[model samples]
Target: MPLALYLLALAVFAMGTSEFMLAGLVPEIAAGLDVSVGSAGLLTSAFAAGMILGAPVMAAFARPWPARSMLLGCLMIFTMCHVIAALTPSFAVLFATRLVAAMANAGFLAVALRTATRLVAPDRKGRALAILLSGTTIAIVAGVPAGSLLGTALGWRATFWAVAVLCLPAAVGIATGIRPAGRTSLGEPDHEPSLRAELAQLRTPHVLIAMLLGALVNGGTFAAFTYLAPVVTATAGLDPVWVPVALMLFGTGSFAGIVVAGRLSDAHPRLVLGIASPVLFAGWLILALCAARPVLLLSLIIVQGVLAFAVGGTLIARVLYAASAAPTMGGSYATAALNLGAAAGPAIGALALAGHDELAPVWVAAVLTGTATLMVLPSLRLIAPRAHRVAPTG
Candidate 1:
């Protein structure tokens, strides 16, 4: 891997940590901010909404700038928002800061994918992207757990402060370590993709299938994960202190899964998703039925982490492969779609918790996961023939 990509991964790791660590600290955040826990959970939803809205918007703006500069600007925004979040006294201010951070995250990732791909030979783009996305996976495993611990030990404010501090290094890494790939600036490129051209990518059954499946899979995963704390504490009968540890264990599975998934994706994208889809489906099924036992609950969760992430690398690669026209724009749309799922997951899970409190979340997650697995049928047919094929020879 190139040094530039490594630095970009570090920046992404910090950003991913900040985005995901909130789940483990939702109760604390709600109490500290004087908001309902549901409202505190909206902090996560708000970020996902920002990503859903901001990815395309940023991609449009970034069309006019060099990729390197655009990434730097995005990280700067991310860093500043963390600072604002760390210092804010009121819940409203904190909410606003989260939006800013989300925008930065969405935009940076959209640009980073295109930039990272260009940094390597055409044949290596898949591997490069896999490496880049590993940062997000790594965050799930290590950064979020660490952040949760920090939030638990010192006030959640201290966690945000630490995240703010990380931006300094990330910003410097982008400034000095990352080098632009081509003479033609990312902003000034000719043959700009029209909105019509970009939208047409969605019309392709393959692209649409990939997007929908990505949304479904992510929705299912988040539906269960969003309420993980309550499930562990209330359902699994775990100590409050053990909640974050369970989350960390889940993250550990996710990190390992991402690495393994990346290789499997490069080799056989279709088979990887096909095999993992059922595992995820089964994991949720078990969680829904047997969540009463603490040990069984933890085991199911670890399995969920592994199975849920096992197909991620394949899914992202599929989007890029299926969308032949305006790949970057199409890819950004997929990113938006994934965020849309993220947004929907918690909202749906919370709604399910409205009347029947105890069994609602698990039932909701099981339904979503089952639905998601069924949705994969179309995507499977779409990619099966070429599943094991290598990158296109440019």
Candidate 2:
């Protein structure tokens, strides 16, 4: 694998940490900005909105540029936005920066996704993507918590400054690691994808369904993951200190899941998905029922995290492979799909929480995951007809 792939993951680690660390700083931000905690929470939502809107739009705009250029350029914008965020006093100004920074984050991810897969051979695409996705798992396990601790000790502004500064080394590394278009064959699009062709893929049944499956599965995963702290503490009656340990376990399981998926997906994508999806969903149902038990809840948290990303990482690889021909735009489709799910999942989980049942989110997750599993059958049939050629055990 290219060092550039790791650099790209570095970029993802910074952005992913920025994406989630806000949850820990909401109180600080609300106090500093003289707004309600709910208002500060909207900044996070606004960031998601920027990601959802920017993925396809910014990707289309940058398709003609060299991959390295777009990536470095986006990193600069993202970094500058965070700097402005740290310096800004007005809530509105900070919110504007989140929007711009998220758009840049969206663009970087779109290009990085395509770039990572292109760096490796077809059979290793899953592994390549797993490496990139590990940045997020690692960020969740380590970076976000670290950022929160930093913010608590220093200030929220210091946390923003740290995120901005983190981008510098990654920028330097990526600039050195990724070959420029003039030097490398893979660093630039051979042909700019036509708008019509990009749109056409949305109409293709398998491609469309694969993207939707990615979203649905992600939605289901986030539905439970978003409320995990509450679920373990309230439902399972674990002490508040155990919450962080639970999160770490989930993050560790996520990393393990990606590693496992990377190894199995190329040869057994069908079998993995067919077997894991139901098991994943069943795991959620079990959690919903047994979350009152601390040991079981803790154990299943790791299992659920493992299954969620194993299923998720494969879905991403499937999206990339299905839209392989549209090298310039494939990543944007994936970005849009996953973010759509990311946006919806937490909202659904929040709604489920309105009924006073800590386990309601788990039940909703089970339903969403069950639907995702059902959706996958048709996608598998269409995306890989060879699945029909393989034995039932496969």
| Top model number, lDDT | 2
Number of clashing pairs per prediction, in order: 3, 0
TM-score of each: 0.90, 0.95
Candidate 2: count of backbone clashes, pairs at least 3 residues apart or interchain: 0
The digit string of per-residue lDDT tens for model 2 on 1-394 reads 7888899999999999999889789999999989999999999889989999999898898877888999999999999999999999999999999999999999999989978888876557778888888888998899888898899999999999999999999999999998777534344455656877776776776667778888888898888887888887888888888887888889899999898889877667887788899999899999998889999988999998899999988888777777765777889988888898888888888888995688877888999999988878766766544632311211
lDDT digits (tens) for residues 209-323 of candidate 1: 6777777777877778777878888887889887777777787777777776666765566677777887788878788778778888888888788877776556766666565
lDDT of model 1 at position 219: 81
lDDT of each: 0.76, 0.85
* Candidate 1 residue spans exceeding 4 A from truth: 24-38, 123-126, 181-192, 387-394
Once fitted onto the true fold, the runs of candidate 2 whose alpha carbons sit more than 4 angstroms away are: 182-192, 387-394
